[model samples]
Target: MSKSFNAYILESRDKPLIIMAELIRKALIVRFQDKRDKMKNYVGRICPNIQKKIEGLKELSNQCIPKWAFDNLFEVKCHGEKNIVNLVAYTCTCRKWDLTGIPCKHAISAIFFKHEVVKDYVSHWYTEDTYMRAYKYIIYPIYAG
Candidate 1:
């Protein structure tokens, strides 16, 4: 599950930006470092089969968004047979994102709707490592010196 999907669940409960961002951060860190914010190894496993599917969709060279789905930023229809619902910006209608901080199948499907996004990176959830790595070593704590 990607971090953005997780964020969408927050959408259902009316999650504040701060809370949504926090969950995204955790997911990313785990993906990049194979560890969590507290430096602990992940205890669970995401489906490798799903990972491969996400990869295949990303590799497409054309704007191959399936015809059955919508293109707006939010609420795209399912590809075909999949009952999953996709919420483009906030969450997928399938409610997986709402139930848990994870990108459901629909969210991934929406991402494919806009093939420009790199699927491998998109599907990989966010984590604190990316956040800290991006902004760390910036102005130190005021009390430090």
Candidate 2:
């Protein structure tokens, strides 16, 4: 990452600081606009990368056995390890869901047991709308002569 930034700096090293800054700003605007346009027609509920991760976890969830404990609570056993899942809170004893904003295998099993849509439980931050919102603002170009 540092090397990439260094290359950008090297390209504008002969110019004054103000000119260098403007060049970098213009480069960033172009990059951001490209990204925004690229995702403009996306229709997925969640971002593709995050959905892929969730699909992988869904397969793993089949190995887990979920037992209903109480309202919105479940005990899941997987590979001889026990975990607690709370649907309302969107948490698991393993803490993976709490930290990553993505449900862990245990939570997946619990959600499956309840016949709930796995994608619905995912954090809004991983949604396609949120991803688009992140690149929504444009950086207008300036004549940096």
Candidate 3:
């Protein structure tokens, strides 16, 4: 995000354009390496951030009540609202699951009713494999002239 770059801008100020550019590049490489290292220690199928979100959703799902409608279909009642969840289709009437690629509380309740793991229902884009692939390539370090 811009917040990362914004913090380095002040440090690069008063330097020549080329030097500033190199400084920013070095900063980014270090930042990326740190991220990669942090991810290496994380052991989960889904990325840590998304996993945290799922954990929060799991807690919320406990409040929902799921009723069997038909095969792969469930009617979930949560907070006085009714949401239809289709396990096979991976969809919820509330549309939160469709929008976020992560199952919403309603869908999670239905998922729990089926005795299935919520992580398996998450989109591949949030998988650890995808995340590692994104940061796999190392940035070559440039030496000072």
Q: Estimate each model's TM-score.
A: 0.32, 0.84, 0.86
Ranking by lDDT: 3, 2, 1
Tens-digit lDDT track for model 1 on 1-145?
4586566455434557776655555554445454233334332233344445545544531232333445534343444333334444445456655665455555555555555343333333334344336434323222324
Cα-based lDDT at residue 3, candidate 2: 92
Q: 1-145 in candidate 2: lDDT tens per residue?
A: 4897688567876889988888788777887787677777666898878999999999999999999999999999999999999999999999999998999999999999999999989999998888889888888766548
Q: Highest TM-score: which candidate?
A: 3
Off by over 4 Å in 3: 2-16
lDDT of 2 at 34: 78
Better of 1 and 3 by TM-score: 3
Candidate 3 Cα RMSD after full superposition onto the native fold (Å): 2.1
lDDT (CA) per prediction = 0.45, 0.89, 0.91
The reply for model 2, stretches above 4 Å from the true place, is 1-16
After superposition of all CA atoms, the RMSD between model 1 and the true structure is 13.3
Q: What is the descending TM-score order?
A: 3, 2, 1
Structure candidate 3, residue pairs in collision:
none
Task: List ranges where model 1 is wrong by over 4 Å.
Answer: 1-88, 116-126, 130-145
lDDT at residue 30 of model 2 (Cα atoms): 80
